[model samples]
Target: MHASSRRQTNCCRKPSTSGAKAPDLGNYAMSLTAALNTALMGLSTIQAQTGVTSGNIANAQNPNYTRKMVQLTTPAVGGDPMAAVVAAIVRAAAPNLLQDYYGATADYSRLSATTDQARQLAEALGIDDTGGGQTPLQSRLTSFEDAVKRLEATPEDTTLKALVVQRGQELAKEVNRLASQRTTLQSQTQDDIRTGLDTLGDATKAIAGLNAKIIGQKAAGMPTGDLEDLRDAEVAKIAGLVGVRTITAENGAMSIYTDAGVQLVGTTAQSFSYDSTTGTIRNTNGDNVTAGFSEGSLRASLDYLDGSAGALTSSDGNVGAMEKFFNQLNSMARNIADVVNAAYGSNLFNYTAGDAAATLAIDGAFTADPNTLDATRMGAVQQAMRNTTLTATQINPAGEPNGLSTANVNIFGLVSGVMAYHARQVSDNEAARDSAENLQANVEQKFRNLTGVNVDDELAQLTVLQNNYAALAQVMNAIREMFDEVISIGR
Candidate 1:
């Protein structure tokens, strides 16, 4: 309600001639008293304006606090049209710019998460971004191949024969280590997803609580500027986590939902939880909306786990970078075992028919006695190891077709290609991330300019209000002195 008051007073009138009817006074006369009341109203309004300016100055450093100003509205006071009230407090909020900032933030978060996770994968593979001749897997293959060639050159040399066995075992161990990293990385992805869900749930719940408070305060005719600022910050956080669309209610409440129409919050917030056992996320509605995520950090994590969304694979189905690299290592190991065994027309390496790369091992008999490799078949083994035109089928032929299935491709060349592919992935993603970062910064700055506070402007407004306040105080004093002078003359 507006701050106003009504006063009634008895008016003295001259006796009517010959007992005629007395003239009626409708209300208080519009004299110095009215002028004094008007000045008082002006002082009250200015005081409210100063309060708003003070708040703006106090919260100038607050990123979420938008600048506020008092809105004066003229309300009719009994037949007087000049009465004004501090009707409302207006905020410097721009809906369109805020929405744009939220959108840019979501896109940038997804891209950044994808790139950061992939970089971890590159590190796990021992894939330095530098474009050296070969990667870890490729280097192992080359060293093993060189050992085989040395054995071929001096078949009677026992030490060279032992060296070949040692090289083969070392290469197999490398494949085992890289394959293990995939499991570790996948587990890490799951933990990250759970952490993200916690933040999303907390933000949604806080927004819902704020919505309730805002509605109550608005109904009570109170200002909800601070509560609204906090709520908007939470909403922006949710936008980056899940990329939501917000709907504002008539009573200053807000509802949140994904673009697919799944409500995350109404008067009460919806609950979201992650189940590591099933590797899925379920909302309060009991629906798994993992695949429905379009853009956000959650979407990036989902893609990494599924190995289908943001994973880096070169036509090896829809596997991620780690899985793809594991497949390549397995294929190379089987090829090494199969080629060497076939060259000798005997089982030189102990690789099972349907086992993984970790199963590739040198035959115990060869490791025990190097003289066995001094046979004529050693020539064929050297030629097979040096062959660059080996087909995928010639290499292993038992497993499913994969990235290493290109025809007439050398094993070392395949490893080198994967290394180069990862290097390009890191480079391309970093470039895209930089672009997104710049765009996000640009839109955010524009949004802040429209809604954020300027301390200098607020201070200037404060000075002006102070001057008006001083003038109103002087007017009140002058009116007091005039009333006293009138009383003295009457005495």
Candidate 2:
């Protein structure tokens, strides 16, 4: 055969080792690259997960920090089957639990404010001092009664007359001091209302600003977990100041309103103005509207200062309980002065016409000369002290008798009744505060269980991430060695 014919025959002849497989270097390189990419992706996911777990562990003690979880999702990349990406970082917060916590906090704050004011009133009234065994007012009243009885037994004792006058002055002083304390409380409440308004304004504005930021971030496909958490915290704070309701829109915008349906924040924050002089809550448009606050520190202060719930006298259509208490004290002072002046034919006590409690004093004639306190009219004095038929018109111009029209009551009895009523109010408020605190604790615990970080759980998650990272690294090392082997073979 010719040389060309022999070469053709050799090319067409079958190989001796038919079982041996030939390596496809192009396909092997592609497969190795794809595998390396997939392993790198897995390592990246583990890194992200480890960062998240580390963050959780670091913020375990932070009350404001919510636990973060990274969600994994497989991408549509054609190269690798196991490659994944981070889809989102989720904050472990339950909206229902958050709302419940806000409500409980508001109730607790309201009760706390009310109880604090009541305790202050009790202290001022000298009724809460157990160390003295008896209140100063009670002691003075008892001493005056004793002196009057002794004067009745021995009408000739000028020294007993002086003692009776001294005791009467002491009783008047106590009443004046209590009334003054009430006035101070009213002033303090006014300051608190102003402070609350300022706080509300600041918080609402902050919420509105945050709403804008959140909306922007959501539109830009940015993570808003931290901003949302901050906004929620601010909302909770506002709820504690004034019971509020929140509405979240689809665009991540949030609106806030009072429980009474008064808008506080929306696209723009609404401004509030408080008129301490009129005890009115008004909007920026200058319209006076009822606050109608149910549970909050502001609501509690307003209730104690001017609310209609616990008034002693509902006359004249006025509702502030503290104001009514003060008015009742003034009326009692006026009644005592008028009756004593009528019985002794001398002005034993002097007081202003409208504000008798604030200005009650022992007359100079009675204080300087004990004889001016005549014991001859003991019967008339006793009758005046026990007078129950004293007309409301004589005591207060706007006051009308409460309960029975012809009922009989002494000065001490009427005053004690009002004091006891307020004391009961204080006790009830304290009980309510305690109940709310317990409920708050339970709700807080429930919330923490659902959203709080557990060290053991986090550690377990970290271990899993570590193992994944190690496995992915090994796969990467294998891919690198395979690439080197393929290069050596090519050389």
Each model's lDDT comes to: 0.73, 0.76
Can you give the lDDT of residue 150 in candidate 1? 76
2-85: candidate 2 lDDT, tens digit per residue: 999999999999879878887788898998998887788788888888988999999899877788889889876655347788
In candidate 2, which residue pairs get closer than 3 Å at backbone N, Cα or C atoms, i.e. clash?
A: none
> Where does candidate 2 stray beyond 4 Å?
1-21, 307-319, 338-347, 355-358, 379-409
Residue range with the least summed lDDT across 10 consecutive positions in model 1: 1-10
For candidate 1, write residues 64-97 as lDDT tens digits: 8999978898766677765366988878888888
TM-score for each candidate, following the candidate numbering: 0.84, 0.87
As a whole number from 0 to 100, the lDDT of residue 236 in candidate 1 is 85
